[model samples]
Target: MEIKEVKQRKEIIEPLLEVWQKSVRSTHHFLNEKEIVMISQYVPSAFENIPHFIVGYDEQKPIAFMGIDGERIEMLFIDPICQGQGIEKN
Candidate 1:
């Protein structure tokens, strides 16, 4: 797998959203659509001219993603279809 850092939301946010929804589906009784909308809305403003996203892909298809905020890991999600493959272990 090739790990890449993507800075543009237009390029990365959709995949992030896909994983985010799947991860939260079972636990959240009612998914907050507005929260996701807010995230998409504020991502551009939240960017700090640094690498905030790490995407792991098998060739061209993304398998896992992580959101890094400085030294803190803010979000991590591995595609449900590809879990248990150590994709998110890193």
Candidate 2:
């Protein structure tokens, strides 16, 4: 697996959105379908506003992503299948 910064946020928004939704659903059991859909509406804009964006790839396929603002991590979502694989620590 390789983790790299994404210069163009657009390049990873769609794939990361899929990762974000899948991850949220799998882990955020308190959220309902409607709530998830509502929150998803803002995901792309959030990506746009993030100062630093990075993605993790496995075999050149997107598997995880993070959005950083200054020294804080604003967002992080890993594909459900890929979680617990040490990608976050990497």
Off by over 4 Å in 1: 26-51
User: Model 2, which residues run further than 4 Å from truth?
Assistant: none
Pairs with steric clashes in candidate 1:
none
Candidate 1 per-residue C-alpha lDDT over 1-90 given as tens digits, one digit per residue, 9 for 90 to 100: 888887665665565666666655534546586765565555434433335887788777766777788899876767777777676666
RMSD of each: 3.5, 1.0
lDDT by residue for model 2 over 48-89, one digit each (tens)?
888898889988788999989999999899999998878899
Give each model's whole-structure lDDT.
Answer: 0.66, 0.90
All candidates' TM-scores?
0.63, 0.93
Range of the 10 consecutive residues with the lowest summed lDDT in candidate 2: 6-15
Q: Per-residue lDDT for 15 in model 1? A: 58
TM-score of candidate 2 against the unseen true structure: 0.93
Q: Which one is best on TM-score? A: 2
